[model samples]
Target: MSNVIIIGSGAGGGAAAWRLTSKGLKVQILEAGPSFDPLTDYKQDNSDWETPFPVKEGSQGGYIVAPLQPLTEETQDIRSWSFMNGKYVPGAFRTSFGYHHVRGFGGSSLHFTGEAHRLNPKSMSLQSDYGVGADWPFKYEDLEYYWRIAEKISGVCGPSTEQRSPKNDRVLGTPHPISYASQALAAGARKLGLTVTENSLAVNSTPQDDRADCNYCGGCLRGCQRGDKGSIDVTYLRRAMQTGNLTVTSSTEVLKIITNANRITGVLAAVDGVLKVIEADLVILSAGSIFSPQILLNSESVHSPEGLCNDSDQVGKNLMETLLATSTALHPDKLGSHRGLPVDWISWDFNDPISIPNVIGGCRFSPSMAESDVVGPIAYATRIVDGWGKDHKRNMQEAFGRILSISGIGESLPNSKTFVDLASETNSHGLPLPRINSYIDEMATDRLRFMMTTCRNILAAAGCAAPIEEFSSIDAFSSTHIFGTCRMGNVTEECVVNSYGQSFRWPNLYIADASVFPSSGGGESPGLTVQALAIRSADHILRNKGVQ
Candidate 1:
């Protein structure tokens, strides 16, 4: 039997494979999508590229990938996403809406903005802070060392002051100077009694670990052609391959987990529609939030008829996504903003309720590098810009240097209703398709509105002529940051994975993906948190022989 078989070669699996193989263990990684050569597959000019239809287009049969944003339902290669209200609705047959990510070697992190911030201590104690959501089995301190490890491995360079733990005391490289726009926004926010800090991002600011610094090109959403971004393919996966103990099988879809007497034994996969099975002593499911749970739900055996390691019925519950929206403001004078950092200034006060009662959210205001093709022209033409060619150019010329673009990211509390399960409809291979039943509670929506209003006020305070807020509909949920389809908890009955990320029902099975996040780490970007937890879980598995 193989020593380890890791599903998905994303952040979690890539980190695990790096750590495990470095410890002199054999590891095989299975990815459901084709291998993407960054230079070959990515096109910087999106205008020439084939993009998926807009969500308002009401069609489901196309797929597209943006380097920064997570994949939406409109980007699906096939109309296969199932939305769950009562019965599952197929993607092509009906307009089943969802914010599900796609299959890839690096997973959703491939398209994520390189902002990497650790979770606040309060996030680890959700039950204690809000009287809602379960607390994490482990504390931030438990993963502090691993956080640093992941940081060094990924070559993340940011302000050392942003790190909450002492173990993260050492600064890896020179901090990127805060942009002029960020400095000005911070000044304005301070007037409102809100403190804005330089954001902790994962992009390399200086040369470290053989990786180059960011060119400040600001095309992060289209994939980094510069090689400065610290994605898994550049970091862990690269190191894992160096060890020669890790084998990566791209374009291989995992169909089921082969188990015997409640113990994981092997994995069944389909590579280009050819069946392949490999026996393993240990299995780590790091297929991501939605896909991870879908895998568990699809894997059925004599011992687990419902799904593998799903005796608790909590495999696909407590779904949560961070609330997000953009706000636009017209500045009095040209700030020359969009030339610097991606997300430079952020409000820590808005992430929690210490500042605002009964409301948990976070707000960040910055100059938006508006997309010229998709959102910007559409937004300008639909509302503000009245005329077509020359008049539109004149209006865009006026707006281009004067626009102050802002964005707000909020958290959604754990609610079982916002979950993903298998739809009744099956895929082309006769497997049940994934279904999303996600909906934000009133608290989350209210918090979103509050953040948007706060953004408008902040812009106004910053000397904007006028600021407008854009509201999102309930149907649009997938701006990346989806969590809790396979949560961790104190008890076997309430959660799918234990504190150590081991399956309660299956002894040799484990999960290292974002799906195991207990309460979604509500505030800040969760890239560091995911890496820290994966490193710690990997260390635990290696030491304790796979149990907590």
Candidate 2:
């Protein structure tokens, strides 16, 4: 039996595995998807210039082909393209909200935009400070060291600590070069009295951690071909593998957690085609917010008839997602919109400030098309530009580098109405599909409207001609940052896991993912927090359990 069995090889699982292996623990990771090596698997030669305006494949508006079978007959839906995509399972749900996640060795890290930002201290203590959302059991100071450790391991690049908010001050690397479009946006935001700063990214600006420096290819979303992006496969997982104490089993799906009385004994999984039982002294579920709850809820036994480690019945409640709004502006002169990293600039001045009325959480502003190619540009132009034929082609050509977009990523509070539960139907794997129901409350809607207005004003201030408002409200399917399904708290009545990510019902079982987040921190990306918390969880396990 392995010392620890980690389910999922994403940011959380990878980080925990790395830390545990470094501490001389034997770790086994089971991944539901195939292994991905960026060096060989990344499509470097495929450029959007070759095929402009390709047919939309998914509900999230992405064109890149994923390496998985198409949706099963039972899951097909034209309106809900998420079900048709290989990346996600099509479970029946009532709300427009869906998840954008990848099932692979590196998990969603493979397609992350690389924007890495820390949550404000105030955001961490939301309930204590603002009377909304659950307060994190631990303070930000407790995780600051782990955050720095995560930054070093991921090779994150960002502005100096002094330049950023005092709430987040531990810097590990230098920031990437700002694009012309970002500079213009920053200048425009400054005119509107909003502070714009360089965004911290997982992509390398200078060669470090044995990874090559970013060459400014502007294809971060498709996958970083040059090894500059810090996906888990290349960073934590690679290091963990090198330690010789870790074994990663890809293309293996975990069906349920096997429990012996009150303790978790192992995991029952489908390896290749046959069912296999892998025993472990400890089990860490990092299958993400949507699937982690699904696995736990499926693990029914005589000792725990409801589910393993779900005595509180809080395993799949409080599903939270980032509320996003986007606006496009046509610059009078070409500003080279599609250059450098996708999200080079970020402004947090408007995010959940105490003075802003009806604002319970913050919002972040970033350049929307830094990583876009010709196809993306053309598709976006079709929405903003007029008529077809020669005029359309001419306008598209002219708008390629002249148009720029700014997006607002806002924080949403976890409400009782939004949650993840078992659907009536079963998936291809013969397991109950996850049913997600998410709704934007009046306060969240008002926050989105305010964020959109701020984006428009910034674009206009940036000297853009006729800044057009494109989209608003939370795109339930578009958010890659999902959290709060299996939250951490001091009491079992409110949370599934404790502050250290250990299950209250089953002590040996831990959760190292966004699912453990008690409150979704501000508008910043949750990648950094996920990794930091995982590292912290690993430390807790080592300190309590010791080397087996």
lDDT of each residue in 1-548, candidate 1, tens digit only: 55899998878898898888888889999887655566656665455332321121111212221112222454232111112122223232223234544456666566566777777666667677767777888887877778788878877776677534335474555666776655666666778887676666677887666777887755555566666878787888889999999988876788888888858889888876788888899999998777788789888778898887688788878877756555555666665555566675566676543344566533334434332111244444454455578988887767654556666676667775677788776655678777766555667666666666676667777777654334242224444677888888778888898887888877688899888888765456676677777777788778876433
lDDT of 2 by residue, 354-467 (tens): 535767887778888642232255455544566778988887777777777788888788887778887766755677866766666767767777777777788899888765
* Clashes (candidate 1): 7
lDDT of 1: 0.67
Clashing pairs in 1: 63-75, 67-111, 68-111, 68-221, 79-92, 99-478, 350-361
Give me the candidate number with maximum lDDT: 2
Structural similarity to truth (TM-score) of each candidate: 0.86, 0.89
Candidate number with greatest TM-score? 2
Give candidate 1 misplaced runs (Cα > 4 Å). 45-102, 163-170, 360-384, 473-475, 545-548
